[model samples]
Target chain A: MAYTISADGLRKRYGDVQAVDGVSFDVEEGEFFGILGPNGAGKTTALEIIEGLREADEGTVSVLGLPPWPRNSKLLPRIGVQLQASSFFERLTAREQLQTFASLYGVPARRADAMLEAVGLTAKAGERVEKLSGGQAQRLSIACALVHDPELVFLDEPTAALDPQARRNLWDVLREINTEGRTIVLTTHYMDEAESLCDRVAIMDAGRILRMGPPATLVRGLDSPARISVPSGVLPLDDARALPGAGEAADDGVSLVIETRDPSAVVAAMAARNALTGVQIHGATLEDVFLELTGREYRA
Target chain B: MSTWQSFRSLGRAMFLGFVRDKGALFFTILFPMMFLVIFGGVFGHQSTSKVEVVEIGAAPLIDQAVARDADLRKTLKVTRYETRAAALKKVEKGDADAAVEQRGGTLDVHYSAADQVKAGTAQGLLGSIVESANQAKSGVAPTYRLAAQQVEDDSLKAIQFFTPSLLGWALASAGVFGASQTLVSWRTKGILRRLRLSPAPIATVFAARVVVSVGVALVQLALFLAVAQLPFFGLKLQGSWWMAVPAVVAGVLAFLGIGMLIGAWAKSQETAQSVTQLVVLPMAFLGGSFFPLDASPGWMRTLSYIFPLRYLNEAMLNVMGRGLGPMSALPQIGVLLGVAVVASLLAMRLFRWDSA
Candidate 1:
């Protein structure tokens, strides 16, 4: 199978910080590949390296079988990129912005109208970019990126600052692009978004891929404990951790919650210890699996 | 896509961008026109008011004595102030030529440093008036002699005096280097980075910006010239259009290089603007935008020589004012070319791909 993106031992550093220290991955053609990580997990740094925006200090990266960098490469026009927080000329209309990008790619300007429509920004085609809502601007950005109908696309947090509805709308657009036999590589921190959008996901941390697989497979592999909630002040933190089958117990403002794989066993033991009264079981989510694998703390 | 095609596309975008930017139009074009109208209206064609001497006391004969001296009457419009103190106040304010007081047998003259030449002229006139009074009232004639010098040149015009500097400053004001700033900002916004991944070469984007900007700058130049040629001002273009055409093109390139250097060297738009001011402000002022300095000190003149605006101004002045040929402007042209080459090289060197 042909891979849309391939990298081996990619390494990049700025000053003393090893931003993308020796990362390697292959994204299959037409696959929606997602890079999921916490903030500063080197997701953006790694994406930038593959997109040809930054040079890798060591290792090789090939996008659609061509090196991306300052040197001339034929693969550039065949790829579309939606960068996080990218802006258009404030004075330019959405259609004009799209057309400009199309022209830069040496594509016909007629496609700009269609791209705008695809992104649901056709009604605001003549409106200046500065006047567009946050969602509208994002849609416009996406339209500009896709004006040339490229086969490979890179969207770095394409829906980062959008409202839920806008984000959903953008996701639908991305799906449509993917459905048309084009491959996509996106980086996002929203676990649900990554699960919903990506065919395969890579969980990154500290400039390295901690895990990579299909979302379902990755989630299933995690032996994360199901959470149990109890009334506030019901159990002390130490007593809960000491219980059999309990992994960790955390206190919510009004409730005590515990993580454990064998929820039933833990509940019975808690009942014997008089620690299960008023406790409730909740289903596991991607956040739980993420916290279990990456630790339940924020990293800058 | 070929490089030409990419540049063409970028050029179209830049032109559209410029057209849509109303604020830029207002500041670059309209604001400068307003300034020119206000300052030119106030100062242009106004004669110098150098000196004022108030003759006081026992001058009924002195009044008649002033009437006898045609040279004094022609040169000085002696106004009668309430007192010598009032005249002295006028001199202190740089409003008077001199104040003359005759108390007892002593004569006192008060004048300002600003009006030194006028003061001397006033003193000479006063002495002649006194002599004439002595001849008329006391029958004692005093001997004196005077010389006169005359010059005639029908070349000077108000527009020519203002245009060169105004053109340079206006072109430099919000243009030239502004393109680089815009590009850098686009990069910061991630738009340029996105563009970088596209088929278009980054060099094409730069070329397009220059093309559109140069075109707009030419339009502004034409507008300033048109405004200067209204019936009242009647600005004459004395030099061959050929002489000025190349210089204007050269001036654009030179300043564009300076602007590019600022844009490339500075990390942010704000820093670029500040740097642009550092180069533009002094060149506009000291290089002779607001006022021409024919009589300013040598050091000041020397400093002006180092500025591209100064050479541009001199070259333009020679062509527009003296009807000189292109060869007459070779030194200025050479300096402008040198500035352009050096600035372009520096800009290329300092140009950064990322905001960091």
Candidate 2:
């Protein structure tokens, strides 16, 4: 498949800190591509480089077959963006803000109303932006981003501050837009959001793409198919590891955890011994893949 | 919509934004007008008192002669005083100009030195008394002319002088603050970074904002002019409104251009605000908006000439208050245009769309 965004050996530095270091990735057209990492994992920085916002120190990037900088004015109308910290002139009504954004792309007047309605902000269009609730303002921001009707849209942590219902509403709007043959590239820290919305995700850390694949593919690649947990005092660690298909076991204070390629076999053995009372088994998930790839170190 | 259409849209947005901002309007219009009315009323009363002088004192013998002289009685509204000290006290406080004391043939005249208007009136009275004494000795009298000079009255009140300037300050401040603050906030918000990936040119965006700001300022000036003509102020345009209009507009752009430079270069909105305020407030005050420059210190007058506001006020005051034409205002216009060009060029050079 052809890529809509392509970058090679991208590097970016902020004074003494390497914000992005030797990163590379490709996003295919019409694909929901997610850049995922812990905060400060350089996910945002790498995405910015690919978006043509920052110049890579020693890398090349092409978005829609054009260099991002020496900013290509001719290419601007083809894309939409939702900034991490979105804001507008406080006194402008939601309708006015949308209209202004539409004008920036030379879009028709009616497009603004359409975009606002799409974002479910048409009812409050007359109210000033400052007066809107956080969720409403966020919806207005999204409306402004879509007013131009670009083929590609970039959203950064768009649903971070939203309530669950609002987040779901945004997801539906995004899905509708995606169905219209537009590509979406998003950055997020929420694994669940990344898993559900992205067709493929690039896990990043220290300015590097540690792993890249579909959520299911990444999880299946883990050495352990399932993990068993139990109270730490319930079983001896050596004995738990000796179970059929159990590769290792560790005491986790309240549970004795075991990794197994076949959790059914391990459960059958536990049941044969009548030792299933305190055990729980779960398939490997995106979080396990994330923790394995980026490590569990706390980032500032 | 094309690029130009986008610009028009942004201009509309800015205009609507300001229209809804009551605080901004208050400072731009009502606050300045209030200052004008209060300052003008207080100062106008003081000015009128100096123009209408009261001269006191007379020898009873000369008073009889002066009261009998039809020519003298018609021109001078002379009042009798109980004591010479009382008359001199009034002159000293600028309430009266001249006080004459007569003992035999020697006449002593006292006048206030603080007010130039009072001093000039006192001098005229003294000259008349000297001439009248000489005429009396020669057994002849002098005649007075009753014709007034045809100087058309375009006397500007304090409000009339300050309204245009307050509007200029508002426009310039909004332009500088809007662009500079918006840029910084957008950067902090990661909007600029996202925009870089798109095909839009940052330079084009900046240019559009400047264009919008200048356009809106012109409209705001028209509003101020209309408000000046209301029944309360009774302002009249002495010169062609044409000359004053463009001059005021150019002045606003010039200051806005300078503000653009500060906005484009400053790292943060806090820095931009301080820089713009530091540059704007002094110029607004010393440029003769709130007060006339005639009696201001010579150094201050020389310094005021350097600020775009001063030249703008000069051109505006010339046309609006002095009835001068564009040709007469070319010098100030030339300076402001030069300022606009220089500021624009510097702003462009200093502007950075990214975090660089």
Best by DockQ: 2
lDDT per residue for candidate 2 within A1-300, as digits (tens), equals: 557888889888989889888877787889898989888888777866666666788888888887776556765677787877765754888888887777767777778788888888888988988888777877788787778877778888888888888888888887888888889998888888888888999898878888999998998887656788877766678888898789878886878888888888988888887777777778877888999988887767
Residue pairs in collision within model 2: A51-B197, A72-B199, A73-B199, A75-B199, A76-B199, A230-A255, A231-A254, A232-A254, A232-A255
Quick one: RMSD of model 2? 4.6
lDDT of 2: 0.72
What TM-score goes with each of the models? Answer: 0.79, 0.83
lDDT of residue A6 for candidate 2: 84
User: Per-residue lDDT of A1-300 in model 1, one digit per residue for the tens?
Assistant: 657789999988888888888899999988999998888889999998888888899999888878876554588778888878766765788888887788888788899988988888889999988889888888788787788888888888888888999888888988998999999999998998988989999888879988889888887787666889999788887888888888888887798888899888889888987976787898666666677767886555
What is the Å distance of residue B202 in model 1 from its true position? 2.3
Per-prediction DockQ comes to 0.48, 0.55
